[model samples]
Target: MRVPMILALVTVLAGCADSHRWSPQQNGSARITTSDRIFITTPADGEYGDNVYSGSGRNTAKIIYNAASAKSHLVRIGGLAENYQDAINQAQGAEQDILIFPTILHWEDRATEWSMISDKVEIKVEVIQVQTGAVISSGIIKGSSGLATLGGDHPQDLLPQPIAEFVSSLF
Candidate 1:
C-alpha cells in the first residue's frame, strides 16, 4: 500500500510540471513601418479587471505600449477609454496614424496538480487606421507561464515575450 501511494504522488507531481504550449492567431493586414506614428489605446471598463488571475486591461496596454515602442519611432500611450470608438477618437486627437487596441479575452490561474499553479492569458490585438477606423491587422496572443505556486506574484513578467512575438509577426 505504501509503494502504491508513493507512485501515485509522484505521478501527480509530474503531471503538474508538464510543459505549456501557446498558439497565436492573426487576421487582416496592417502595414507597420519604423516611421509610422502609433497610439496604444486602453480597453473599456469591465473589459479586463483585477480578478483572481487576470490583471487590469491597463496593465496589458502598458505591456503592449512598451513592446510597440521598442520597434516603432512615434508612439503615444493613452489612458482607459469608454469603448473602442473612444479609443479611436483619442488616437485621432493625438494625431496618430495608427492605433493599437488590446483586449483581454481570457485569463486563468489554476493548479494543474496539487500545489503547482500556472498562469495563462489570451490577448487580442487590433491595429486600425485612425482616419477611417478600418481594421488594418489583428492577432490573438496566447501565453502561459511555467508551473509554479507563487499565486501570480509577477504576472507582468510573463507578458513581454508573447507581446514581442506578436509584434514581430506584424511586419
Candidate 2:
C-alpha cells in the first residue's frame, strides 16, 4: 500500500499532472547546436486586461537562454520590442544565423492558497531564419500552478521545465 501510494504521488506531481502545456501552431525544422549562432528578441508584453499587463518578456528570454545553454545550445537576447513587425525588422537587420522570437499572450499570478486561482502563463515562441525571416518553428506555451503552490507561486517559477522541453524539441 505504501509503494502504491508513493507511485501514485509521483505520477501526479511528476507525470500526468504536468502543470504546463505547449501547443505548436507551426512546427519548424530547425535542428540547432551550440555552434549555431542564435539570437533572441524580447517579446512585447502581453496585454491581459484593462490596466493589467504581463511583465516577464525579459525574464522569459533569460529563462530560455539559460535553459538552452544548459543543453549546450547558445542563444543571444537583444532588440527588445513590443511590436511584431519591429521585432522582425530588428532581427532581420542583425547578423545571426537564426532568431527566436516570443510573444506573451497571458500571464497571471494569483494567491493559489487563498483565491484558489492558479498562477498562469501563456507565451508563443517562434524560430526564424535571419536572412529570409522565415518562421521555422512556432508554438504557444501555457503553464500553471497546481494544488502544490506552497501557498503562492510565481509564473516564472514554473517555466523552466516547459522551456527546457521546448528547447529540446528544437534539436
Candidate 3:
C-alpha cells in the first residue's frame, strides 16, 4: 500500500518537471553580419543538487560555437574564457568582431525513478561589440529534457536545442 502511494507521488512530480519556456525580447537595431568573428564567453555556474557545475558555462559556449561555426561568413570562432570581460579582452587582443556571453539562470535535476531523471535549464545570451564594448543583442533561451530514462544519453543533452535556435536566429 505504502509503495503504491510513493509510486503515484513520484509519477506526479515527474510529469510536473517540465522545461522552462523563454519569450525572447530582441533589439531590432541589433545586427550580426556574416563577416563577424565570434567569441563565446563561458557560462556562469549552475546548481544541481549540492554541487555546482562550473563546466555548464563552457558547455553552453561550445554549443553556440558549434552552431555558429557552420556559417561560412563567420571568420573565426573563439573558445571559452573565465568571464565576460576576459572574453572581451581576448577577443579585442585577437581583433575579433563580436563576443557572446551565455549565462545559466536556472538548472534543476530531479530524480523520477531509480534510473530516470528530469532536467530543466534556463539560459541568457548577450552579444557585444568587441571594439566599442557595446551590447549589440540580448535574449533568453530556456528548455528542458523531460523525464529522460538515464543510460544511453547524458541528461542535459536536450538542453542545448533552444540555445542553438536562438543563436541561429540572430544571424
- Candidate 1, residue 26: lDDT: 45
- Model with the higher TM-score, candidate 1 or 3: 3
Candidate 3 per-residue C-alpha lDDT over 1-171 given as tens digits, one digit per residue, 9 for 90 to 100: 999999999986775454655466655466678888887766666777786876766676777777777663564545556567777887898888888877777776555445345566777777888888878778776666556344333325655566666666777
Spell out the clash pairs found in candidate 2: 28-136, 28-137, 44-82
Kindly report the root-mean-square deviation of model 3 from the true structure over all alpha carbons. Answer: 5.4
lDDT values, one for every candidate: 0.69, 0.76, 0.68
lDDT tens digits by residue: candidate 2, 25-120:
987665776687777888766555663554577788888888777766556788677676777777666667777888878888777766767788
Q: Which pairs clash in the backbone of model 1?
A: 29-136
TM-score of every prediction relative to native: 0.71, 0.81, 0.71
Per candidate, the number of residue pairs that clash is 1, 3, 1
Which 10-residue window of candidate 3 scores lowest in summed lDDT? 147-156
Q: Return whichever of 1 and 3 wins on lDDT.
A: 1
Q: What TM-score should be assigned to candidate 2? A: 0.81
